[model samples]
Target: MLHVNGEAFEVRDAAVGESLLFVLRERLGLMGTKGACEQGECGSCTVLIDEQLVCSCLVLAAGAQRQRITTIEGIATETPTDVQRALVDAGAVQCGFCTPGLVVAAHSLLERSPRPSESEIREELSGNVCRCTGYGRIIDAVQRVAVSRASAREVGL
Candidate 1:
């Protein structure tokens, strides 16, 4: 059994060496976790395991059996998350192949640091590689979400 997206799923017919990325996208049909670089070089397979951002491609599926996993699908509800909306509003999404990883990384950063400096945001998101948008818009989107969240907190919203 694997815990994913706040639900438990029984994994079946999985090989011993199957990567978590394969289990997520292939076995469970959670295609949000992309498999760009199976060697963990690219952040396309980024996911949250026990609230820690990790490259799913590097993790063994069987090893992640009891851990809490959160994919891109798990990050948003019926309505898009502020980070998701901010990315779109700021024109950060280009090809969109890297958007999910960027969104997850930014969300994790904001959860840890509600008010991060520009450099901090860049450092936090350094692992995620966006081939498009040149990263300026992506950084801007993260900052926008941070500012919006801070304002909401101040207004007690």
Candidate 2:
């Protein structure tokens, strides 16, 4: 059994060597987690295992039992998150293959730091690689979300 997106899914058919990325995309039908390089080098298959950002491609599905797994699909409700909106507004999404992972990474960084420095954002998101938009816009998106969130907090909203 694997706990994903606040739900429990029985993964009885997962092989010992099967990766969490495969189980998430194939068995669970959570296509939000993209699979680029099957290796851990690419963060396209990134997810949160117990609130920690991880490359799902490097994780074992069966090994994730009892752990909380949050995918891009679980990050927001019906509407897009502030980070997601900022990413779009900043024109950071192109090809979109790397967006999910970048979103997850940025979300994790903001959750921990709330208002991170430019270098901090770059360091945290270093794992994700976006070939389409370079990285300037992606950094801008994260910074934008951080500022927006801070403003919301100040207004008690």
CA lDDT scores, all candidates in order:
0.92, 0.92
Q: State the lDDT of candidate 2 residue by residue for 1-157, as single tens digits.
A: 8899999988767678899999999889999999989988879999999999999999988788999999999996589988889999999998999999988999999999999999999899989988999899999999999999999999999
Q: In candidate 1, which residue ranges exceed 4 Å CA deviation?
A: none
Best by TM-score: 1
Using all chains and alpha carbons, the TM-scores for the candidates as numbered come to: 0.98, 0.97
Displacement of the residue 98 alpha carbon in candidate 1, Å: 0.6
Candidate 1 lDDT, 73-92, residue by residue in tens: 99976799999999999999
